[model samples]
Target: MNDDLKAAVLERCRRMEIPLVGVASTDRWEHPPFLPWMPEEFYPQSIFPEARSVIVVGLPIHLPVLETSPSIYYHELYKTVNTLLDQYTYRLASFLTDCGYPSVFVPRDGYGSIEVLRKNPVAFFSHRHAAYLAGLGTFGVNNTLLTPEYGPRVRFGSVFSAAALPPDPVLAEDLCTRCMLCVEACPAGALDERDYPEGLTDKAACAANSAELARRHISPCGICIRVCPVGEDRERYGRTTAAGDDDPRRRRAREHVRKYGGL
Candidate 1:
């Protein structure tokens, strides 16, 4: 039955253009760092007490075009990924319901009210971590999931189901070491040696910096992703930028010029 379900899910994912998929036991992920948003009673087992399995899907977000203008392009890419994820998640949920297995979408928006953020500083466990725990990829120093194929260029979504499915054990390798390439590349100074001594991460700092970048509108930097050795190696990762190598912020203002052959 597990094999049949796995095959069916894979087929559906392929049809939907989701490149990666994995499954894990909801039981394995019911604790503080994992379930930071919900109370203990709202754990997967408690909420969907019968749910024995979870199907995790990953959609790659590494469009070379995003690298050209990290601020604008990355934000736009994030929106696109979220839209795709929501559609795929709902489709999977409906499929499970039709098969007589109940399912629900885990909350994707990481931020909640101020009270929630204060109470749960780690309120948002890394989405990539969820994907990794579900055996989708290895954890990288950037605290992003690094798949063998796409590296850190992906977004994750999961489905909890009552149907019993064999679990994919956690991946063996911890791809991230003390190497702080991601830390060094962060223009926002959000990362530090002490916070992620062994590459654990401080989510709040990262979030704050990201927020500031959005507020300032000075070419939101995804330098971390750009410098990630894994992503750099992938030939498919290339960027489209305005001519003359001006700063991305300036280049963006003249995007129309480049497109229409006007200066």
Candidate 2:
């Protein structure tokens, strides 16, 4: 493994102010960590033949900003985070290539649009899964990668590099509490009480809900991640309680924001 290359990559990420980063060897994908693993086509090596290491980076979504679900405020924030992920990953890939290692960045969202997702829900690459193998976090009941710092409230992007950088160990501890808060709070009834694989989200329903929200100019409905109590983010934001919309003042504020941003 190239320890110096890994150090350089870490330095680059630090300079970019990226909070979460992890690396995984391409060989890790060959061994399934759990049952019902993704097909070979989704593997980094499959997509990019030159890839020897996969570097994944994540950016957190502030809990306070995300509290305004289905509103333009959160919608814009989601877009901004995704945009940054793409740019950061792209720049990192360029850096690695310049260092004599061929590399390429994977876009944050591979799909074209919600309409496209409604018909075909799967992305060409799964960053959450990549984030998982890279040791950034574990999977949550909400089907999101739960990080210690941000839980499911983080977006990820990946870079495929020919450099065989030192890989981070997969987190042995599962971060999910399996409280089912995400399942119960889902507006579209897309989630189930069971753990992932057995309780995989209903992508069709999720896409439909997003489609409706898009019509209102507020695309994503981030209720599941908002209600999740994992990560120190909730404590940091003073949102320890899962009871959202119970406070009249906060409810009114959310309503006020929703009214102005969309139809």
* Candidate number achieving the greatest TM-score relative to the actual structure: 2
The 0-to-1 C-alpha lDDT of every candidate, in the order given, reads: 0.63, 0.91
Tens digit per residue, CA lDDT, model 2, 1-263: 89998999999999999999999999999998997899999999999999999999999998877888888999999999999999999999999999999999999999999999999999999999999999999998999999999889999999999999999999999999989889888999999888877789999999999999999998799999988888888777767577455567777887788787887
RMSD of each: 5.7, 1.2
Instruction: Give me candidate 1's TM-score against the actual structure.
Output: 0.75
Cα lDDT of model 1 by residue, 138-255, tens digit: 7666656777666676778877788777878787765544456677867666565642224455657656665565554423356666555563325553332212133566456536
Best by lDDT: 2
Off by over 4 Å in 2: 243-249
For candidate 2, give the lDDT of residue 107.
95
lDDT for 137 (candidate 1): 71
Question: What residue pairs clash in candidate 1, if any at all?
Answer: 71-220
